[model samples]
Target: MWNPKATVENALILLLLTLSVMAKTVFSQNCQNTGCPGLKECCSSWGSCGIKDDQCGFWCFSGPCNLTNKSYGFNYNVSAGPRGPIESIVTPSLFKRIMSKVGNNCPAKGFYTHHAFISAVKSFQAYKRTVAKREVAAILTHFAHGSEGFCYKEDKARGKYCSPSKKYPCEPGKQYYGRGPLQSIRWNEYYGAASIFLRLPLLKDPDRVAQSPEVAFKLALWFWTTNVRPALYLGFGESSKRVDGRLCDNLHPNDTKNLVNQYVNLCKILEITPDEDARSEISAFWRRHLSALMKRCASTRASIITGRYGLSFVR
Candidate 1:
């Protein structure tokens, strides 16, 4: 019984168990208040975030909420690029109007260019074909809210967004945090996946997204086609759930009301009126409210999100 090797093995087992518990807490995805941070992960009725059918199907809170919960979304195509221009919808005047909402000092003001967005659109040929006016407006609503009119280039204070995996095991000095328009990405698997199409070293160089505006827009499209596009037919509410599940079904009316209002306003700008389910509004109250809420949420989460990863493991 007094075997030194056995004692060491037992100690290693205990250390592994401890690390396992820590990982669970780190990726808890409670979503009772804020929504889950993963672009494609679903929130369950029990308030957890994951990509399994158990998590994404049957009362899933948001994300790619579907019966076919398994994902093979990363195999993207750039072949369909530039067949039709997205600028036809996001015209120069319209783009300017969106940027006007932010002050001159905002980082996104200089970072997000109309040309850059158009270039990104050209890379995905099916985008315009697959999305109609309302769908386009829905995405713009998200852009306006999430990026504050495309001014927020990167999230300076966020968790390292790394999960342990043999294929994409945590790197020694790399930290994949939030960048791009949506800024919800925080997983290594995603970085690796996007890199295949982008043909860049995203896993080692996650900052390329925020640094290059075209790449940023392209990444945004990648997230949308893979995640939200599936559930959008359900209604505007479904779109909201995909973005952040906790914001729907009376979970957070304050947030949901503003989202619907913004969608209504954007649809009108494109001269496309939505049905009653779209909750059309012609005013800009929701825009101001949404901006404020985004700031507040970013501030709150930046303070606590670091706990989502192991320092040595992710960085």
Candidate 2:
């Protein structure tokens, strides 16, 4: 017996399944680990995406969500508001002074502009919590080192840096060697992580990290706030260990030394004393607000001495 109603129902089921697969293929960028895009969007406790109100409002990875069984941790009410903090902290003139240290021989000189850095910084409001003379110096020190004094813009696009994972599958033709300041490596994880967090199509278009300076700096900041900033209170040594433990363990003692020396130099440039324990550093820096107000635009004083790094700046 030909059952028209049954056939119609089966067709509808197939269509719904197809749509679900497509949706997951396109937008599911490892929501389980990094959560969904946007600050208010929710990644359900078991790995599903929807507005904050979905699933009893429980935001698993991100949010002090309205509906929740538990709040693990979230970036609520921490952003530096918008558009002014980075500019105020590192003005164009100040950034130029910082850039002046790069040898004229360096490549990609124009790529790492203050405008690009400021533009990228706008997307990361959590950065507000990490802004201090010592912290800022640490941030820029890693920036210069990971980007190799802002010289090497793109990786050779060699080697399939992809790993097999259903959560964040690799695009067939794309390579995922970390780009930009953080040199955000591990495509299977960080690229997808960045995709969800930044709400950008980074997994599909990983090149954006290298092609646009703003995107590049955003990748760096993403890595920094998520990984480095949290460990900052432990001290610079721990922060460096978090960045690359091998370097700290005598794998490349010189590179580790370079990190400390670069931080010291940048602190000098900002007229700040480099020290341990980031919370106290921020508290202390703000206490001397009158000086910080002037030092906020840390004028690049004297030439920045050259610090050589390995060609591989991966972190």
Best-fitting candidate, scored by TM-score: 1
lDDT of each: 0.61, 0.57
Best by lDDT: 1
Off by over 4 Å in 1: 1-41, 49-53, 67-85, 128-131, 246-252, 276-315
Q: Which clashing pairs does model 1 show?
A: 63-242, 80-125, 108-151
Cα RMSD of predicted structure 1: 10.9
TM-score of 2: 0.59
Candidate 2 C-alpha error for residue 241, in Å = 1.7
Off by more than 4 A, model 2: 1-84, 128-130, 276-315
Score residue 278 of candidate 1 by CA lDDT: 34
Task: Indicate the worst ten consecutive residues by lDDT in candidate 2.
Answer: 296-305
**Which ten residues in a row are the worst by lDDT in model 1?**
72-81
The all-Cα superposition gives candidate 2 an RMSD in Å to the true structure of 15.1
